[model samples]
Target: MYRYDDYDQRLVDERVAQFRDQTRRYLAGELSEDEFRPLRLQNGLYVQRHAPMLRIAVPYGLFSSAQLRTLADIARRYDRGYGHFTTRQNIQFNWPELAKVPEILAQLATVQMHAIQTSGNCIRNITSDAFAGVAADELIDPRPWCEILRQWSSFHPEFAHLPRKFKFAVNGAKEDRAVIQAHDIGLDVVKNDAGEIGFRVLVGGGLGRTPIIGEEIAAFVPWQHIVTYCESILRVYNLHGRRDNKYKARIKILVKALGIEEFRRQVEAEWAFHKNGPSTLTEAEVARVAAHFVDPAYESLPATDAGYASLLDENKPFAAWVKRNVRAHKVPGYASVTISLKKTGVPPGDITESQMELVADLADAYSYGEVRATHQQNLVLADVRQSDLFKVWQSLRDAGLATPNIGLLTDIISCPGGDYCALANAKSIPIANAIQERFDNLDYLYDIGEIELNISGCMNACGHHHVGHIGVLGVDKNGEEWYQVTIGGDQGNKAAIGKVIGPSFAAAEMPDVVTHLIETYIANRHEDERFVDTVRRIGIEPFKAHVYGNRQTEKKVAHA
Candidate 1:
């Protein structure tokens, strides 16, 4: 992780002091609730349904063990004992007192973390692949670029108050694990035919009321022009993006209104003015940033560890966990271990303070003192040794973090729905809980195989329901809670939106509806085809027929 420079440190320290004063003023009655709302929001403090929520940025989802311990301390001392990890890889505390947020920011500053741009209409956290450095297949590590953008966008004078929030993601790998196509600005690090590194830039991708896959604006932008080209894109959106209505204020709306070609043309025109400007990255500057991300000292070991093999032979549960939670690392003898937060009966992505501390400890002991927050809302120790897998798993299990449901049905991705979010129409957590309860069989989940079950409480798609293999969107019908089910959505390299099967089901019927969909896939799928591939091959009509059935069959079943 990049250490804060002198300028960065000074800026954050001053902002904390400023927010402290603002908080004191608000508490002293100098500022009304309405008057102080935007100020608090810009500082990443939200007045939620129950209490104030403080979102702390985990830049590019990277954190040191010490930083993780600090977060755990904050969760324990300042708010509830648990914190929710968001899709953007940020952590949110739901019960932080409004008056204490500035103090929290002060503490975060000590660890080189802050809540800036976690909220508001400005450019938010710049996210990237969780397995960036250790992944076997990567064009380049993306954290350096992410950090550059983080510095450029933080408190940017001209773009600070955009019409709506903007999100950017960078992917250096072939797999779209970062969901780059679903961001406002997505950059893919690529190598040209001559083996020179550049970027494939995509613009206008977003999800809300209007979901879109970003269009390629620049196919091979040189590495030097990254910041310049990004500024150009933002300037185009800032000038023309809708501001009259919040719903249509995103850059996606602007891109839609102008067509991809015209949007690209406009961005190019803007780039013509700034491509070689001061924001352009120099080789020396790039080298300086890249220096912060030097590879860890790794020992050369065997491809397979005998200790891990022996443990796997003795413990079936441990074997299952290793199969699911462990990922192949680019280096031999090292593994990327995902600590599943989606345990049965526990809320997905919610980790207690103790658990966080334990993870921090294990990261220090076994993974070079580094941690990563995955977009799947899970925590990762990205450089664990194969020999230490059992000890790590035991520690995680003691902390209630050992759930072997990485890609299982019960491993749901859900937004903080009506219970917390002001935008939700219905509670999604309860629905997720109900489904988890109904499907508690680990063997069954594994048999069903890799499936993405995502739920969004509203149309904003925060949970990415549109891209789940089994997507559930909560709806309000006649003042009652309902869930609409969709199947065949995917968010990987071949990203596609799901198609709705039929009518919406009551909240109580959601579990059964999901069960029916899975059963339909199981029965109809040929050989080893996954749910998504089957749906794409046969289309949704067959699944629809099974879900709704024929008119006569439905009547007969109802009568029975």
Candidate 2:
């Protein structure tokens, strides 16, 4: 985990003091709503349907147990005793009083955390793999690179206000846990044929309104020049990206308007300005940043623990939970455990204050006092000892954090839709709950196998619905809530945007539609094929035939 130094601490402290006065001025009517809007957004405060929603940045989804405790305390004192983890790997408090946000931010600063750049048109939180450094298949630790970008982008005046909000995701593992292709800028840390460390850059990748898979802008940019390459891409987008229509303002639209070749040419031309300039990273700079994310003090132990093996044989429940929740760690005798927040009937990603405290306690006791928030809205203890697996599972089960469904259909990623966000067209939590209930049977879900179901209130793609194996987007149809369904969307290196089946459906028809889609997949799938795999293999037509034909079959749906 990265610790904030004096400079970092001072930066956050000053922001808190500055925002306090800004909030005071707004409340005193010295600043109008228009004047206060950007100021509040820059501080991660949004006036929602019910109250102000405060988003706290958890850089690269990494935070300390002490920070977690502070978050829990803030939720208990100022919020409704719960916080929502988002797909960007940040947490949101939906009911914070606008007047009290500065106080909350001040408390966050004490623990080296802040809400800066969590919202607004600036670069949002930098996301990475939950298993970044510790994953068995990792090529290099991405946390350092993520941290480097975090430092470079925060409060950078040049990119303070782009055509629209920007996002960056970094991945270094064989598996693309960071979903790089769905971001404005995606960096894959790779080694070239000559065995030199470099970055494979993907620009103009995003989801919302128009969902497009990213193109490979640069095959292998040397690691030292990644920052400059990213700056080049952003510079191109900042200059030419549409600003008049908010809907067409994204970099993705610009990339589509100008072909990928032209976009790459423009970026390459821009890169020449600072290709190996002072901004280029040096070995010392890399080491200085990486020192913060080195491997934890580990012990020599056997590959498998005796008690853990016995428990796997003795308890079927524990074994099932382990199969879904536990991932292999690079270090022997250690494991990464994902505490699923997608429990059935619970709002996906909502963690209560007590639950947050429980996770912090578990991290201290088992994972070296560090916890990683996942882009899927889950919490991870990345360094749990194999021998202590059962105890960790027991503690989590008691806390209602162990749902034993991590990548299953019931493990949904959703946003706080009509209930909290004023930008939402429909309620997302209810749709997620309905789908979770529809596939509540554990054995059935296990059989269905690795699938992503994402729901969003609107097209901002907060839930990343466009990349889910099964995606549900809420639409507003004549003041009523309707649902739009897309299938075959997959993330990772071979990322692909899902295809819309036909027209949208009423909210009541969503569960049935999902059920039929599942049935269709089961009927057509080959051995060991996942839902997304089956969708890709057989295409969306068969699933569409079953869902629309039987449910309304003739492609019946409502408004766009």
Candidate 3:
């Protein structure tokens, strides 16, 4: 993790002090609720349904064991006993008192963390692959560059108040785990044919009311000009992106209106003037940042652990956990374990303070004291030894963090919907819970296999509904909660937005509808094909028919 220097420390400290004063004024009644909105938002505070929610940034989803412990402390002392990890890999406390947020920010500053840019129409947290440093197939770790952007964009005067929130993601791995194609600006770090480092830049990709896969604006941006090139793109957006309508303000809409060719031309024209200027990165600076991310020391070991094999043979639950939660690592005898937060009937991505403490302790005892937060809202012990897998599994199971469903149908990605988010039209968590309750059979979920179901409260797509094999979008219809279903979306090399099946369903009918969709897939899919591949091969007609066929008749028949 990148440590904060003196300048970084001072900047955060100053911001904390500023927010502290602002909080005091608000509490004193000098600042009205309307007046105080943007002030609090800029600091990552939101007035939720019941109470204020404070989002704390976990930059690039990297945190030390100590940092994890600090977060646990905050959750225990400040708000509720648990915190919700967001889809962006940040964490949010739902029940914080509005007046105490500045104090929370002060505490976060001590750990080199803050909530700045976590909200607002500025460059949000520069996310990267959660498994960046340790992924076996990575070309390079993307965190250092993410860190560089984080520093540069923090309180950037030129683009601070943009037309809408800007998001950026960098992926250096062969697999697009970072979901780069779904970001406002996506950078793929690649080595050229001549073995020189550069980037494949994609711009204007986003998922909201209008979902789009980013277009490639620059095929091979040189390493030195990353900052300048990025600035050029932002500058272009800032100048032209709509401000009259919030829905039309995002760069994705601008790109759509202009077309990819024109958007690329404008960015190039801007970059031609700014390229190799003051923002151009020097080799020394890159090395200095990269030094912080060097690989960890590893002990030589065999490819497979006999002890692990024995443990798996002895314990069925542990064996199931290993099959789903454990991932292959570059180092032999080492594995990356995902501690699932999607336990049945619990809010997805939420961890209690006690669970946080347990995970921190386990990380220290089993995984060299390092922990990672996955983009899918799960906690990871990245360097766990295969030999200690059983012991770790036992500990996690006891802590309620072991939910042997990593890629299964029940491991849903959901946003804090109507229960918490002001923007949400309906409660998604309840819908998710209803679905989970309806389909609590592990064997059934396993049979369904490797399905991703994402739910968003609204069209903002914070839950990444567009990328799920089964996507649910919560909509408001005549003061009633309704859901629109989309099928066959994916977030990989062959990324595609899901197509809506047909008419929306009432909240109560969602689980049955989802079940019908899955049944349709099972009935139509070819042998060994995943849901996405099957959907691609057969198209959405079968699923649509299953979902919407004779809707009026079916409703009447059910009533009868």
Report the C-alpha lDDT of model 2 over 281-300, residue by residue, as the tens digit.
99999899999998889999
CA shift at 541, candidate 1, in angstroms? 1.8
* lDDT for each residue of candidate 3 in 1-560, tens digit (9 for 90 to 100): 78888998999999999999999999999999898888898999988888999999888888888888888999999988999999888999999888778888999988888998889899998888877877889887788899888888999999889999999989999999888999999999998999999999998899999999999998998899989999999998999999999999999999999999998889889999999788899999998888888777787989999988888898898998999999889889999999999999898999999999999999888877878888788989988889988889989998888989998888899999999999998889998899988888988988888889999999988889999999999999999899999999999788789999887899889888888888988898787889998999999998888777756667989999
lDDT of each: 0.89, 0.92, 0.90
lDDT of 1 by residue, 190-297 (tens): 889998878999888887778788888889998999889999889999999889999999998999899999988888999999889989898899888889998999
TM-score of 1: 0.97
Off by over 4 Å in 2: 552-560
Sort the predicted structures by lDDT, highest score first: 2, 3, 1
Clashing residue pairs in candidate 2 are 548-553, 549-553
Q: Show how many residue pairs clash in every candidate, following the order shown.
A: 0, 2, 0
